[model samples]
Target chain A: MKFDDLKKLHQKKYRQQFGHFLVEGEHLVLELQRALTRGTLASGSVTLYVSERYANFASPFEKVLLNDRQMSQLSDTKSPQGIVALVPLPEAPTTIQPAGKAIYLWQVQDPGNLGTILRTLAWFGGFRCLLSPGSVDPYNPKVVRASMGAIFHVPLELDVPLAALPDRFARIGCLDLHGESVVADNFVAQDCFVFGNEAQGVPREALSAMGASAFTIAGQGAIESLNLASAVNICAYEIQRAQG
Target chain B: MKFDDLKKLHQKKYRQQFGHFLVEGEHLVLELQRALTRGTLASGSVTLYVSERYANFASPFEKVLLNDRQMSQLSDTKSPQGIVALVPLPEAPTTIQPAGKAIYLWQVQDPGNLGTILRTLAWFGGFRCLLSPGSVDPYNPKVVRASMGAIFHVPLELDVPLAALPDRFARIGCLDLHGESVVADNFVAQDCFVFGNEAQGVPREALSAMGASAFTIAGQGAIESLNLASAVNICAYEIQRAQG
Candidate 1:
């Protein structure tokens, strides 16, 4: 296909209408190939798009073919890693399965921060996400880029109200620097760890509803609170370890 | 001052000449107030510069008040938190101290990632940062926003060569997923932990000289590698635990 045709997928409008988005880099290409061979990919597969120059550059993955300019256009990166693919959007899962662990975000504002936390949740491998009403749009381009494709893999629910959260989850915990130390108690249930807005802790109403006080990361105060992603990683790791 | 006069500070030339930049929001204002009261601000000082409407709102800190139009000129935020400060630049430390724990970033491209790592280092509290050539400029506006004022607290040295790094510190370790289990070893280095380019691990020559192979965050198939900031946080915590 022509390079111009590949570049068209960079737009969200095009991606939504066509149900495909671009994936770049040799590593992701290899993953797509492996997932396809293993039948791990969904029924409707992606066209394995690659530039001829990239194909000649010693990649282990077969099926190397696509236009160079098109590959560059489809890629989100400034310095394209020379490979791009038109991958089908995995169907967004709608059901809130009672996953063994969950992290609920309360009005978290920054797209980059939200994206980083999503990527961390996926990295640790055991939690799902529920976004409060005021949170940044998860589909924002910056969020997608920071998530490193984890947005596709992680189970995410948007526009979910904080009020609706308790009925759907087992035990909910909120992360606050001024509250109880996260280390003191054993998190016994399949838990939902809540991280509030970066500037504010969970709202008083959200805290009151959860019934458990806030838990803080014990650290020196060079700053007021932990980065949202760091807080998620620490809380998720502790919860995972406790479950074991 | 006119709002137009303050708004012009967002330009690089104006900021450089004045040696002042704008910080907006309640959190940063409160933190800067604390820093000022404690006399921690050395590079210069903060000019509270708030609008009248914000004055009606209770302020957590003692601030130099300003009118809304005046405050608007000084603010870079679209929706100014009604509070903005012309904060002094943090004093750069002389002589990169061989603090036993340090993270050296080489050519880390993204400003947000760099800022996130800075916040992570500050949260963990023991780690210092060294930026090799080509790393994102720490002063970039995106970095400052993502850092949440961590730029003031985290000690950093920029444009240092990788060749000179091993000699300046004790243990030198590189993050490579294929090398060794990070959990398997007590990464008790009084030296430097080097995180390479986002897409590439440490350079081959730097790898051999660092006296270690690689270390990885244990995870399943979703992530090929943890984000740079996330990896730094996980490893730093592991190192702290191993030492204790």
Candidate 2:
């Protein structure tokens, strides 16, 4: 396709109807291409649409071709990496099945924190993530950027009502300052991990109703609690290790 | 001081000439005030400047008041919390001490990461931070925000050349992917912890010539290492635990 045609995709109108967003950068483009080639996509197929004028773009993907100006318009970055891809948003996984190894977030408001935590989950394998109704939309642009493509690998289910969580995944743990030590040997492997709000933490009513136990990641000195992103990383890693 | 006068301090020129910047918010304002009351500063010092209209801005600190407009100009935040202070810049700390425990960063570019690490250090307790030359300026606004008030509590010294570091901090452990397991039982507590750039990690020159022993924070994950902030938290916690 011509370069100018790709540039037009940046508008919200085009992005919505087409169900695709321009993802730039050679590394990410190649990764998406690999996923496509491997048939790992959750739903609609991604097309390697490119223009010949932009052929010099140094991406790892086998397929690529786009004109320079065309790819540049699709990029959100200040310095375009000379490549862009039109990727279908992965279909949200259905039949979560409460794998007895999952993460639940309650109203995690910061996009950056949400994305960072999502990336952390992808790093430490095992564990699906479910976002309660109040949580920010996972597909928000800031979350997508901070996640650094981890959203593609991690199975994140959003807009899930808290009441819908199943009982077999019963080992729900919440992080609270008053909770037990996270590092204790008694830490058990469970399916459900619930994180609360950024400022107020999980609502008291939600905590009470969930009947979830609480545990704190211990630190000796001055911090109130780890930042939400940091807390998630610590919890996710420890939980992954404990289960393994 | 009237509110109009207080508003002028947010500008870089005013901050430099006055040698003070507004550190507002309930937590930060309280922390600075506490330090002042403890006689941490010289007598007749802390100008607990706030707009007189903001007299309702309650704090334990004795107010040498300013007006609303002045407070707004001095604040970096979009909405001034109605309190601002014109405290003196802290005297540069005395000679950099390598007193058996230290945190070092080499080309750690992100201000948020630098500030967050400083906060983590404060939380872990008993450690001094040293930033290699070319690292992010310690006082960047984003760094200040992410560090919360830990920036005040943690002593961060920057501009030290990396090459000269080992001469003072002899026992330096470089955090690397290929190094020995940092979480293993055999891991020993070291006098200094060195982390490299986030993208490139520690440069080979520093790793080889400085004679810093290598250690890896164990993560069998997708990405190479934890986020810079998360890695710092884990390291600080590990150090404190090892000491205990």
Candidate 3:
């Protein structure tokens, strides 16, 4: 692929067209390599791009060394690490059935929020992240960066609709302002957990139609909302806490 | 202040120079109004700037009308709500005596993280936030926006030294990767909870010098670290959960 075409992976459309996205920085590239070794990421689907400084870094994947200008063009951040990876968009989960409950994010918009949630889900293990249509692209550089490479570990399913959740999981729970406490007895028993958009939370009628139980974090404050990612992180922790 | 001067609030220095910061959008403007009525904010220190669209909106604060361009200049968002407030920097907390335990943030850098943490602090109530000298400006526009108006309700103290914590809180606690579980019986007994910087975390030496107890959230995952705001948010929820 042309170096010029690789730079285009910064945008979602180009990433889709080229069937790959750019993962920049040494830490994330190392994570990609780890994922490759773990067999979670498909082998032979990654291409390492490094500058002169990392020309000798040992890696199994094919390496392409770029000059300073070429490295800058392929890098997303202002301070380029001079090392990046061209990772293929994760192919559909093969025979390896990823473990755990489902976390359905309903059009959650912030790339940072999605990435942070992925990190949280990855930390707890045994969970897959599902993004609703109209959500920010999970493969966006910002989301991948914010995930701290959790993007390579956690199972992700994009364009999973809010409406499809009911058929997939018999018990679904969601956060609501007036719901029962998340620590309540029934909270952790759900098969799937749904979180809403940052600005407009999940519609009441939609949640009711899906028969999803309501659970609130239970707080005492004059403010009305929590950041989308923060709410998900708390829920993930609660679910893990209850298991022990 | 001149219209030209208001534009300068976009930068942190000018915010300090003018002794005020901007809060944009209708929700936040309403939140500021709520704070004013609740006596959390001083009566005369707020000035609302509105475009013709909100010319008749009712509020006790003095209102200034701005043209579309002026409103755009004042707003940090792409879509102006045609409403913004110039709120005075909170003077050193005087006789009001903010309630509850202290949350000491040591040099938290991201505006969104600091703002989200403030929101979490406000949501849980009974917590006054303390920022170390190098932390992000709590009143920066990005912080204010991300806070979703919690900045008005949460009591904040700035430029606090981390070393001063030892003299103030007799029982101090900080999160560590290998510490006891956060859910332990004694976690709620702390007078102050210290959260570290996003990248470096609280140095072991500093934590040791302060005689702070180490508590971990405890999880099983291959990926390491949580987003700073998410960590603080989870801690706030856990503290509140234990209290009940």
Ranking by TM-score: 3, 2, 1
Q: Ten-residue segment with the worst summed lDDT in candidate 1 chain A?
A: A57-66
lDDT of 2 by residue, B52-94 (tens): 6657777665676655665656677778776655555565666
Give the number of the best model, judged by TM-score: 3
For all candidates in order, state the fraction of native interface contacts they contain. Answer: 0.68, 0.37, 0.76
Q: Tell me the tens digit of each residue's lDDT in model 1 across B136-228.
A: 767666677777877766777778888887677656777877656676654564367778877887777766866654666666667666788
* lDDT of candidate 3 over B48-109, digit per residue (tens): 99999899999988999999988888889889989999888888887444558888999999
Candidate 1 residues lying further than 4 Å off, grouped into runs, are A1-41, A45-99, A133-137, A158-165, A188-190, A240-244, B1-30, B43-100, B239-244
The estimated TM-scores of all candidates read 0.73, 0.84, 0.95
> What would the C-alpha RMSD of candidate 2 be, to one decimal place?
4.1
lDDT of candidate 3 over A97-178, digit per residue (tens): 3458788899888899899999998888878888888999999999999999999989888888788887778899998787
Give one digit per residue, the lDDT tens place, for model 2 in A1-244: 3455556556655555656666655555655555555555554445454556456554444455655664556667676666566666566666647353678888888988887787777667676788987787666556766777666667777677766664545667778777787776555554577787778777667667867788877665455656777777777766655665
Provide DockQ values for all models, in the order shown.
Answer: 0.46, 0.43, 0.72
Tell me, what's the RMSD of every candidate?
Answer: 5.7, 4.1, 2.0
Candidate 3 residue-wise lDDT at B150:
92
TM-score of candidate 1 against the unseen true structure: 0.73
